[model samples]
Structures are given as C-alpha cells and as structure tokens.
Target: MTSTEAPLRYTAFTSDPEGGNPAGVVLDASGLDDAAMRAIAAGLGYSETAFVTRRDEAARRFRVRYFSPLAEVAFCGHATIALSVALAERLGAGDLLLDTSVGEIPVATGRDGSGAVVATLTSVPAHSRPAGRDELAATLSALRWRAADLDPALPPHVAFGGNDHLVLAAASRERLADLAYDFDALAAVMREHGWTTVNLVWRESPERFHARNPFPVGGVVEDPATGAAAAALGGYLRALGLVVRPTTIAIRQGEDMGRPSDLLLDVSPADDRVRVTGRAVPIAQAGA
Candidate 1:
C-alpha cells in the first residue's frame, strides 16, 4: 500500500537544501507498519525519516515517529522542525502538537525575518547529570582527546532534552574542529550508555557557540545540525551555572563538513523545556 508513496525531502536548519541536515518526510503514513516504515527510512538513507500516522487539519495535531537508517529514534529534532515547516506551508503557519514516543511536543511555526517559514519546538524536558570519570575517560579515549584538551570551566555532563547527549566542551575551536573518532569504539560506548550523540562544543562567547555531534548510535558519523543536542547543551550550560535562564543561544554547526547550519535555542526560567528554532527548505527534485 505504501509502494506508491514517495517521501518529500527537505533539509533543515538552513535556508538552502545544500546547507543543512536532510530528512525524509512521509506526511501520510497511515497504512504503513513498522516494517514498512523501517524500509522507507532505510531506502531514504537520511539521518532520519519521519512518518505521520494521524493528522488533524483543524487542530494541527499529529502522531509522528522517527526512524533512522539503522533504527528507530526516540526523538528527532531536525525531523520535527522539517515536518513542522512542511505542514505550515500546506496548512498555513500556526501551532502543532506532535505526539512521539518520548512525549508530546508543541511546536510553533511562523515566518522569520527573512520571510522563510521557521519552526520552534519546545522539548519535553531538560535534565543534566555528571559525566562519570569512567565514561568521560572512555569517551576521550575513543575521541583521541586527552584531559588537557577539555575546557576546565565547562566540565563534563550528560544532558537530556528529548534524548540523551554527552556534552564535552573543548578548550579551543581548533580542538573542536579536529574530530576523528574510532567509529567502532565510540559506537560501542554509545550503545552501552544509551547516548544518542556526543555534543562536542567550543564556546565562542557567552551567547555564541560552535558544535559538532557524532551520532554513532544512529549509524551516522556526524550530524550537521542537531536540535536535540543543542537543547541538551543549553540545559547543560544552565545546570553548570555557565549561563542564566531566559536566555537565547546560537549554535553554528556543520561548517567543517561543508554543510553549514544554524540552530537558535531559547532557555527560559519558567520551565525545564528548551525551545529550538530553525528554518527548513524543500530540496529540489533530482530530475525536475
């Protein structure tokens, strides 16, 4: 039944298709089962594919799931943003309630300063815990970074917004840019720890940061723009007293990979949920 359906492709966190993380979107996946959904995600071969099972036009509510090329993800930030913008373009900008495996996420879609449709997703909740010495040591060994390379101020933390991400702050931008990891070793540690991605960041200023995410658990070596990781980092910073609440953070990612992406995050004092905003654009069809 799903054989006739072709997923729409979009790249999120950038205004241009060539600059952001690409995603596969199946707007109507009512007839698809888990097997069919997995197959579609495998075929699309993006970091993640989103399937929408239920859509209420009047209420702008949806039931969604995220599947990577290898496995199903609990939550996917870029895909949510992409799907939100896609829905807005068709139904007009407004708010949407997306029900995922993790929890219900409320997203608001609107026009940015550039007039491009952008989506902001409020995460489920944010939490942070100390990164144990053993975990940090193993991760550093896999990443080939010594203790001297870590930022003394930032420390180490395992942060969660929707999914868990290990946050490591590099002492310098140069150290952050040189990312070469033992894939198998890193993957093993990530699997053991149930980590989605390792959020490696370098602070440019109080408000600006540069980040790279190694998503070994998802079968992706790196993620260009990681909204979940960004949110997690925001929470981590707040937990560590690096920043105050009710603040906005700007993260620049994917520059080293040639696909530049921007993620804007808002952390408020009222709640633990973090808001991540970005624009998504449809990719031009190959033969069109």
Candidate 2:
C-alpha cells in the first residue's frame, strides 16, 4: 500500500460496536512527523492512535508511537492490540516487538479456534510504592471520598508497568460503583505526580475484581479497558500476597459506563511482570 492509502484503524478489547476502547491505527507512519501524527490522532478522536514505522525487518520489530487526542502518551494497550491485529492480517500471527518510547514491548498474536485474532502483551517490569500521606489525602479530597471509604487491606500506592497509576481499593462494591469526582481537581493532582490514571477497584472474590479508572491525565473522564492498569493491579496483588502463585485473575471493568470489558491477567511466581490478554474486534468501517 502506498502512503496515499487510508490508514487501517481498529477498536480493541470488545466484539460489540459500543463496547471496548477504540483506537486509531496507521500501519505505516514513516513519513509523518510529530505534528502530523498528533493531528491525525486528534482528528480521529479516539482515546489513542498507534503509529508504526519500520525499524528492523530481521528482528520483526517496529518503532511505535502512541498519541492521544490532546497529547502523546508513553504507551497505550488498546492501540497496541489494534496494531497487532492489523499486522497479523498481513504478516500472519506471531510475536512482534514494539519499540515504544517507554521501553520495548513484546506482543504475541494468535488466532482462536474460531480463527479470530487475539493479542497478548507482556508489560514492562512492574513495581509499586506507597503513596505519600499528603498525596493520598489530596486524592481522596478531590474525589470527595473519605479515608474510611478506602480498603485498609489494600492501601494507596503508585503502581508502575509501562506508566504510573495510583491504585486505590474501595472498602465496598458500592463505593466502587459510585463514580462522581472533580475532573479538574483530580487532573491537577495527577499532573503533579505524573500519574496516568487512578485505578479504583473492589475485590469481589479472591480471583475476581471490579475496577474503574479515572484518566484525567489523558483528557478522558474514564477509560473503559485499561490494560496498563491491569498489569499494575497484578503487581499490587502479588505484592500484597492476595493471590497464590501462578494464578490467573479476572477483572471486570467499564460495566458502570455500559461498555463492559473483561481483562485476564496471568501472574507468575518467577517474574515481576504481568501478562494481560484479551480479544479485540474491528469496528465497522462506516464508523471508522
């Protein structure tokens, strides 16, 4: 395909039109500059757009960049899924190395028994640290949530995979369902701390969880399916010893917003990183 051909875009993490997160895809963005890429992403108006440029044919790696409508992001999972599916269409399913600005991300793609492509990304090394007392207080105040509403077992902390996220476990499912917050107020705190999203979660069972993410830093009210945050949560769970070793956990998100998404997380005892897997279907062409 020539540069004049239209870009290939796809939504990730859901098979339905209105479910999952939408991402813009440009299979070849070799000639596009930063401004041009940003303009395209802004024009597309998705949460994020993935731009790929050839870097090495022998290694099957490409230099990738992610842009939000408002600004560039270090990494975006939905976009990565979309790009991987798109590439699989041409090169067939296998593993591809994505050289992102943050780090090198390895994505493995394969087809299900029904022949639908699925992509699983192994995130960068995961780590978590306790949130400062003042920061936690400020975050709660901005969200209008009292300290007592927080789950004492899980404490407030900043978790990092490819990006940084603040993990807050609510005391109850009721608290997790209530999603009223000061957008700008929380945005200010996130900006100050360079956080990507506030990962609010409620544990439904030992292996199941419900989560919501407020993504003020990305200029979005909330993210429907956050793969990066899922990786962080896996790290947090492992750190807290909530789950046994070599177990798979399920996370249900975006239900409150009506775009229900399911994320499967694989945690291993030997590694600190987490592997997140999900299915992504292409949005209709008319909508694209």
Candidate 3:
C-alpha cells in the first residue's frame, strides 16, 4: 500500500457498524513513526487503534502498538482481537504472538461453530491490591456516587493485567446504570495513580456481570468494551475466591449506552493470568 492510501483498518467486538467499541486496525505499519501513528489513530477517531508490524512471519510473532485518539495506550484488547482477525484473513488462523509495549500477549484464533472468527488472548500476569479508603472515597466523590451504593462484599480495589484499573462494585444494577461523573476530577485521580480506566461493575449472577469503564485518561467518557479490565476482573474474582477456577464468566458491557458488547473471560487455577475471548468484525470503509 502507498503512503497516499489511507491505512487499511478495522474495528472489533461489534458486527454492526454502530455497536461495540470501535478500534483502528493497521495490519502493516512498518514505516510509520509514533507521530504518524498517533495522527492516523486520531484521524480515525476510535477509542483505540492497533498498529502491527511483522517481526517474524515463521514464528507468527509481531510487534504491536496501541494508540487512542489522543495518545498511546499500554494495551488494548479489542484492537488485539481486530488485528488477529485481520492477520488470520491473510495468514490463516491459529496462534500468534503479539509483543506489545506492556508484554507479550498470546492470541489464538479460529472459526467457531457459526463460522465467525473468534480470538482469545491471554493477558500478561494479573494482580489486585487494596484501594485505600481515602482513594476510594475520592473516586466515589468524583463519580458522584454515594458510599451506600457500593457493594460491601466486593469492595473497591485496583486491579492489573497489562495496565492498572480501579474496580468499583456497585450494590445494585440501578446504581451502575446511572453513570455521570466529573470527568476532569476523575481524570486527575486516574493520572496520579497511573490508572487506565475505572472499572465499574455490578454482579448480575455468579457467572454474569454488568460493567462500565470510565476512561478519562484517554480523554473518553467511557470505553464501550474493555478487554484489559475484563482480565483484571477475572483476577479480582480469583483473588477474592469468589469464583471457581477454570470457569468462564460473561461480562455484558455497553448495553446501557446502546452499543452492547459481550466479553468472555476464562480464569484458571494453575495460572494467575486470564484469557479473554470475543469476535471482531471489520468496519467497512466510509466513502470519502
């Protein structure tokens, strides 16, 4: 492709044009610099974008970078899914290694029973720690959520997979549904703590959850689908001994906002990492 040809990209996690988190996919970005990449991602105006440059075709490993419209991100799950499918279309489906800025992510791709290409990525290690009372209170204040709305059982904490996320479990679905926060206040707190997103979740069942992610650091109000936070939630559940290992949990996100998305996470007893899987569809190019 020539430089004049706008980068060939796609969005993942939603089949419909209007649904899911939109991601920019550049299957080949060998010649692009950081400025060029950031510009491209900004031009696309997606939440996050993936730039892939093959490092070793034989090994099926590629160096990847993630960028939001405004800046670079440590890792992005939906973009990873989109890149894997884009690669599969050209290189055939199987396993591929993505050497990201955070760490190496192993992704497996295959056609499901319905013939849709499904991709699963194993996150870098997972861990969670207590969120100080002061921090939690400050976050709640920024979110305009009262302490009574918090779930006592789940509590508040910071979880990490590839990046750090502050997790807040709501006492009711209604509380989680009404999301309005001081964007600048939350962004300040998140920046000070090096947090990528504030993962707000409400447990619907033992195996099901409703989630919303406030990504102020990325200059977005909310992320429709967040894979990294999903992995972190899996780790949080395991750390709290809330769920059985080797079990899968379904996360229903973006529904309240109208762009519904499904994220499946697999947790295992033997390892601390979590696996997130989903289907990604390419967004058709808009007529210029």
lDDT of 2 by residue, 1-288 (tens): 544466666767776758887888887888888898888888887778899866565677989999888899998877888888888877889999999988889999999998988889998988889999988998999899999999998889899878889999999999999989999999999999999889999988878999999987777898888888999988888777765679899999999998888888898767888888887877777755
CA shift of 231, model 3, Å: 0.6
* Leading candidate by TM-score: 1
Clashes of each: 0, 0, 0
Expressed as tens digits, the lDDT of each residue in 245-284 for candidate 1 is 5889999999999999999999876668899999999998
Q: Write the per-residue lDDT of candidate 3 for residues 56-146, one digit (tens) a residue.
A: 7789999999998888999998889888887887788999999998899999999988777889999999988889988898899999999
Note each model's CA RMSD in angstroms: 1.4, 1.6, 1.4
Whole-model lDDT, model 2: 0.86
Please, what is the TM-score per model?
0.97, 0.95, 0.96
Error of 1 at 200 (Å): 0.5
Q: How far is candidate 2 from the true structure (C-alpha RMSD, Å)?
A: 1.6
What value does the lDDT take at residue 195 in candidate 2?
90
